[model samples]
Target: MIADARRAVVRAGVAIGIGMGGFVDGILFHQILQIHNMLSARIPPDTLVGAKVNMVWDGVFHAFVWGVTALGVALLWRARGGSARVPGRMFGGALLLGWGSFNLIEGVIDHHLLALHHVVERLGPSVWDWVFLVSGVALAATGWMLTRQIDS
Candidate 1:
């Protein structure tokens, strides 16, 4: 019983970490850096006229991401019988890595080809975009590897 509780805690912590990491990324890039939000492209011209609309949408998006992540953690906890098993850890790690990869690739393609705002709009756009991509990949990989080690 105690072991089960401990495992549940660990899984929840891992989920929180991943979700918080994602939140930080969104806050830093979308808010502080003034980069494009998830749906920046869909906005009609001269609607909000500035970053206000983007900020609102970004907040909502981050909220949803956080919710989903928390739900994922709950599901994992239930599915694995509240144990930090090797498979659970690997699955969580892979999820983080996949999300990071998607962000990196999408950011690059959108900024470079689609003319969307860079990862950090204030930082000369393209350069910061690449930097963001690399950093995201690094973070995700590190999380994945560390989780794998924990599982092992």
Candidate 2:
């Protein structure tokens, strides 16, 4: 039996948050809105072949995210038989923290560093990237606050 232990199964929640957040970003911003793709800034989807390539890369990205979400689900299932009581706030906080972390890390790595993609390709490297990062920060802060009180 896995004990909730000192961490309160935060890892599970965080993983879930990360997966969900990434999906929203990828689906909403990337696909639904048709704003940007994984390699939009690099290869671009201007040509038919380019669009196909971007679509493939986008699928790859989603696959990875799906794996992340599956991991989170596994963690939660294990925690169900644990010794400690998982707090609602703790879960939520961890979730937000995970989302924020995703935005911050992804934004910095892909947008700023590697130049794999931009927050909004049409807008170029403008306030969109900063906004993405800032939103992540806000989510993280909120999660931090929520997790302060140990429900257990």
Candidate 3:
């Protein structure tokens, strides 16, 4: 049987992964880099007013990321009452899984299906998007393999 501690650790890892991933996307692409906004691809937030609109979307996105982080912390806190020993591999693998899963699902649904945004806006469904998806697959696969090697 999988101990609650292990389960909690995995969940916590996933949460952290998701939160970190979101922050990476938001900070690297959205704010610091300013390569793309949440709706820049769709709405083309070029003007001051448009940028304000995109900022709102960005804020919403950050809020969601914050929530993911909070959930992860809660999971970790719960684990404190349990066995307290969580395998490093399990946690690491779960982190990769969660982050990769986010990229894969978000890329497919938002970029491809919903036409929300692309990895590179000016490129317009170029190689960068595929690279993003492939990277996610690679990370997730590696993580899954690592987890499988362990006894869960």
Off by over 4 Å in 1: 1-18, 33-48, 80-99, 109-115, 150-152
Better of 1 and 3 by lDDT: 3
Tens-place lDDT digits, model 3, residues 1-152? 26666677778988888887888889998898787788877788788888999899999999998999899888877775655566778878888988888788877877788877788777777787788889789878887777666654
- Candidate 3: segments with Cα more than 4 A from true spot: 1-3
Question: What TM-score does structure 1 among the candidates reach?
Answer: 0.57
Q: Which candidate do you rate higher for lDDT, 2 or 3?
A: 2
lDDT tens digits, residue span 12-124, model 2: 88898899888998999888999999999999899999999999999998998889999998987777564445668788898998898889888999899998888889888
Error of 2 at 68 (Å): 0.5
Compute the lDDT of residue 63 as modeled in candidate 3: 97
Clashes of 3: 0
User: Cα deviation in Å at residue 66, candidate 1?
Assistant: 2.1
Q: Give, for candidate 3, the lowest lDDT window spanning 10 residues.
A: 79-88
User: In model 2, what is the error at residue 96, expressed in angstroms?
Assistant: 0.5
> What is the lDDT, from 0 to 100, of the residue 94 in candidate 1?
53
